[model samples]
Target: MEKKADQVSVWCIVSMASIPLVMTLGNSMLIPVLPILEDKVGISSFQSSMIITSYSVAAIFLIPVAGYLSDRFGRKKVILPSLILALIGGLIAGFASWKMDDPFTMIIIGRVIQGIGAAGAMPIVLPLVGDLYQDDEEKASSCLGIIETSNTFGKVLSPILGSIFAAFLWFLPFFSISALSLISIVLIFFFVKVPKEKDEPVKFKEFFNNTKKVFKAEGKWLYTVFLNGVLVMLILFSMLFFLSENLEKVHDIKGIKKGFVLAIPLLLLCTASFISGRKIKGDIKTIRLVMLSCLAVMSIAVAFVGFTNKKIILLLAVTSIVGIAIGALLPALDAIITENIEKELRGTVTSFYSSARFIGVAAGPPIMSIVMKNFLNGSYIVAGVLGVILLFIVFKFIKENEIGNQTEKA
Candidate 1:
C-alpha cells in the first residue's frame, strides 16, 4: 500500500508538470511568427495584434467558469475536453492559414476557440496539483514552481522554434502547436488520475454562498497580491509588445534579427526563474522583496526605453533587468496562491488568478499600442507610469501573510 501510494504521488506530479508545458508551448510558439502573419495575411498592425487579444478575451471570461466546473466535475474531465478543443482550434487555424482567402480572420477565430479550451486546462492544472498534494503545501509549491519553469523554458525555446517553422512555411507553426496539443491530450488521458470528489454536489445557491463565505475569510490579502501579480505580468507583456513593434517599425529590424533581439530579455527571465526556484523555500517576505524590486527596476527600464536612441545595448540592458524581475516574481506569486488557498476552494481562487492574468494579457498590447501611437509625448512614458503604479500597488496593498496558514494568508 505504501509503495503504491508513492507511485500514485509520482504520477500525479508528472501529470501536473505537463499542464504548463502544454499551455506555454501553445502560446509561446506563436510569438516569433506574428510579424510573418501580418505580412502574409495582409492585415493592419492593430488587426495583427488581435490574434493575441482574441484568445485572451475568451480566456478572461471563460476561465472562472471552467475552474468552477473542474471543481464540480473533476480536473481530468475538464482537461481532456480542453485538449480536444485546443487540438481542433489549432488544426482549424493551420488549415485556414494554409488555404483560406482571409487567413487572419479565420486564424483569429481559431485562436478564440483555443482560448476557450485553454481556460479549462491552464487554471485547473495548478488547482489539481493542490488537490493532489492535499496537505503538502511545500511540495505543492515546488511543483507549481517547476511548472512555471517549464513555462519559461517553453518561452525561451519558442522563438527559435517558431523561426524555424516560419522559415519552412508560414502555416507550419500552427500545425506544430496542434501536434503538441494532441500529444498533451494523449499524455493526460493515459497518465493523470484525479481522485473523485467525496462530497455531494452543492446547488448553485449553495455554491455562491460557499464562495462568498470563502471570500469573507480573513486572508483575502492573498487574492489582492495575486491580482497585482497579474497586473505586473500585463505591464511586462505590454512593454514587450511595444518594444517589438518599435524595433520593427522604427528601427527597421525584421526576421531572425528581431527574434534574436527579443530573446535577450527572455534569457534573463529564464535565469531569474531558475535561481528563484532553487532558493525560494516558503519564504513569503523574501518572495515579495524579489517581486517588488523587479517591478521597481522594470519601471526604470521602461523609462530608459522611452529616452534612449542607442537602441540595441540600452534596450537589451533595461529589458534584461525587467525580465529577471518578471521571472523571479511569477513562480513566487503562483506558489503563494497555490499554497495558501484551501483545497476545496483552490479551483475557484486559481481561476480568479487566471482571469486577472488574461485581463492583463488582453489589455496590454492595445493599450500600449494606443499610448504609443496616439499619446505623442513618447509611449515609454505610459509604460513607465504603469510600472510605477504597479510598484505602488505591490508595496502598499500586497501584504506578506504567514506562509504556513492556508486559510487566509493572502
Candidate 2:
C-alpha cells in the first residue's frame, strides 16, 4: 500500500483540498443565514449563536486527539471516518430543523456531532500535505498554500451559498453540509494516495513526552501562533455574525444580495491570504514580520470602526481592512507553526493550533452578542485592544525565524 511520494497527482491535491473547503463551509455558511434561523427556530441571537459555538466547542476538545490518532495511524484512515460522521451529524441537524416541533435541542446536539467530525477532517489536511511531499519541500509548500487557499475560498463562498440555500428553505444549508462532505469523501477515497509513513508508531506516554519536549523548547513561539489563531478567528467570526444581523435588519438587505455584501471582506481575505502565502513562503523572519505588521494594521482599522458614525461605506471599508490584515497574518501563522515543527510532531502540534483557533470561533458570537448589547459603540474598541495585545505578544515572543534554523539543525 506504500506509494511513491512524487506520484502526487493534481486530482489527488484537489481531492485533499475538498476536505477543508467543505468543512469550513459547514460552519461559516451559517453566518449569513443566522438571521433567518433565529426567526424560524424562535431562538434568540444568543441561542442561535450557540449553534456555531456547539460545533466549535466539540472540535476544540477533539482536534488534538484527532491529530494524535492521525500520527499514530494514517491521515486517510482518520479523515474518511470523520467525513462519514460529519455527514450523519449534518442529517441530524437538518432533520431536526425540518421535522421536529421542538428542534432546538436536537439541532444543538446535531451540531455538536458535526463539531466532533470537524475536529478530525479540517486540521488533518495540514500535516497530510506535508506528508504527501516529504521529498520535495517546494511541492509541499505549494500544496500547503493550495490548502489554505481552498479554506479561505470556502469562507468567501459560504455566505452566498448559505444565503442561497436559505432563500429556498430556511433549513436547507444544514442538509447541504451532508452533500458537501460526501463529495470530499468520495474524491479522497478514489483519487488520493498517502505515502506510507516509515516511523514506528509512538506509544501514548512517549507521544505525550515528545509533545512536551517540543512545546517546552518552542512553546513561546508556538503559543503565540496559537493565540494569534484564536484572536483572528474571534474577530473574524464575531464581526461576521454581527454584520449578518446588521445587513438583514438595519440595512434591509437579505438573501443572496446580502450574502455578496458580506462576502466583500471575505473576498479581500481570500485574495490577500493567497498573495501573502506566496510572498512569505518558509521565510520565518518574513512570516513573523508580516504577522506583526498585519496585527498593527488590523488593530488600527478595528478601532477606527468605533468612530465610523455608522456610515455604511466607511464601516465596510474599515472592516475590509481588518479582513485583509487577517488574510495576511493567517498564512504567516500557519507557516511559522507547521514549517518549523519537525515532521514527526507536526500533526499533534498543528492540531493544538487548530483547536486554539476554534476557541476563538466558539467564543466570538456569544461574546459579541454581549458586547453589542451592552457596549455597542465600544465593540470595535474592545476587539482592537485584543489585536494590540496580540501584536505586542508577537513582537516580544515570536522569534524571527530562529525556530526554523533550529529545526533545520536538528
Go through the candidates in order and give the C-alpha RMSD of each one to the true structure: 2.8, 2.0
Clash totals for all candidate models: 3, 0
Clashing pairs in 1: 219-408, 221-410, 222-410
lDDT (Cα, tens digit) per residue for candidate 2, span 168-227: 999999999999999999998998788766678888898888888888778888888999
The candidate maximizing TM-score is 2
Each prediction's TM-score versus the true structure: 0.90, 0.96
Per-residue lDDT for 278-356 in model 1, tens only?
5776567777786688777777766666555346677778777778877888777777777766676678878988888
How much lDDT does each candidate structure score? Answer: 0.74, 0.86
TM-score of candidate 1 to 2 decimals: 0.90
Error of 2 at 207 (Å): 1.3
lDDT of model 2 at residue 67?
Answer: 96
